[model samples]
Target: MNKNLRVPVGIFGIFLIIAITLTYTLNNLFYLVNFLYIGSILSIGIYLFVINNKYGRHLVQFTIGLYMVIFLGIILQENMQLSGFFYYLFLGVFQAAVIHYAIAKIFGPVLFGRGWCGYACWTGMVLDILPFKTPKNHERVKNLGLLRYMIFILIFIGVLILFYLNVPNLDYLMFIIFILGNLIYYAVGIVSAYILKDNRAFCKYFCPITTFLKPASYFSLLRVKNTSEKCIKCNKCINNCPMDVDMLDNRRKRKNGTECILCLECISNCPTKSLKI
Candidate 1:
């Protein structure tokens, strides 16, 4: 294979494996179709990025984002939210929203880091369109990251209570909660973006899903690395990083290292291309 084709080909092959394996195991043709579509979209996005299209990342985000949000969440009523995860988990069912959480936000982080946030997150698609793509120091207030834990605990507790109460029409309730949850997420995301002057304020400060993503991503096979030789210490990478990741620090345990969304903004901003993802 041509070197330029390596990334896309690898991604396509991986998704093919996933598609085949899941379809065979689950005896569901939908798995094959679903994975094929997502794979193709991601492969195209990767190719565009290799060719240096300015909107390559955005293309993937919007394509996968809108499909997951509208088709799965709204039309199919799949409930692809944190609450949905808890709801499904409590039911001991491995299908639907639980599978999505396992593959995208949980174990998937170990392989691709927070690539979902950059490429396919419906919430991020909306948040990234805000004015503040790059966050300033003042916008990142201290201790705000702790809020995600609070949100996580609250979601878990809320779901547990509902289950304990033997709530009827639980599927209907989940569908409603999914809609309401997304609305609250968007409202909070937009408000936080404006107030913090950072487009990713909601992601950095209060996304409950991060509780799963961060720890796994710490051991991720793919992550941005910084080399100081050609860096010039210009601070361009830090300035443009939406996640406030210290790309200048090469260690995997660097401050906010687990927060990297693999958005490549820092790499794009580097004068000497010292940053590699």
Candidate 2:
């Protein structure tokens, strides 16, 4: 029962106010330069900047703020389709060959410590909107953390099989699956955060992107680690960590956990300020 959530309720309230206001204002003016879309971006940007006041230093907030900036950029650009950006490059049917070649055949991690989760994941943004306090029962499901790799392989294989067969409606199928998957994921995330008191079980036990990022993130420069002899085992670091990593445990083992997202929440919220880069 951690019972301490850094994210405040007023944050969501602000988002709602802005969203509703923009919806009515921009939707009504939809004919005027497509202000609806632009207004939505502005509304979200204002909300994030305003909400940052509550959890300005938290890692989750930092990650979310970074993503909002990128998303706003894309929405404003008008040439870049957000769905295409995600599907074509990062997590679409076409990406299988690139992922397999880089991660499997070449035997290299994809990035470094799943930094993508912190930066580009739209699903993570959805969860970041919810306010929940306390860590959940992430004790240990199994030692074969490699299960996620197996899942990725299977998904890649399915994509390849369908590709070689020249299956009709493939793009449409992928689009449908993508939309449904996101809906289910965010639905689950919101429900879990509300009822189960944990915001990140989706990241822990389920996210396919997390699996992709795992191999890539080992080589990333942006990562999380405890400083030299600074932590006092106050558990603030662990408590504040959205990813449920036992920072104290990492300190004891002289390693950063594989799931670390480098969001600065732990460091900022630590009472002794022992949590650091």
What does candidate 1's lDDT look like per residue over 1-277, in tens digits? 8877899999889899989998999899988988899999999998888888879899999999999999999999988999999998999988768878888889989999999998999999999999998877734688988999999999999989998899999889989999999999999999999998889999999899999999999999999988658779998888888888888888999878998988887887898989886
RMSD values, in order shown: 1.3, 11.3
How many backbone clashes does every candidate have? Answer: 0, 16
Worst 10 residues of 2 by lDDT: 75-84
lDDT for each of the candidates? 0.89, 0.50
Q: Which stretches of candidate 1 lie over 4 Å from their true place?
A: none
Please report the TM-score between candidate 1 and the true structure: 0.97
Model 1, residue 100: distance off in Å is 0.9
- Model 2 segments beyond 4 Å from truth? 1-112, 142-147, 191-196, 228-230, 249-256
Q: How far is candidate 2 from the true structure (C-alpha RMSD, Å)?
A: 11.3
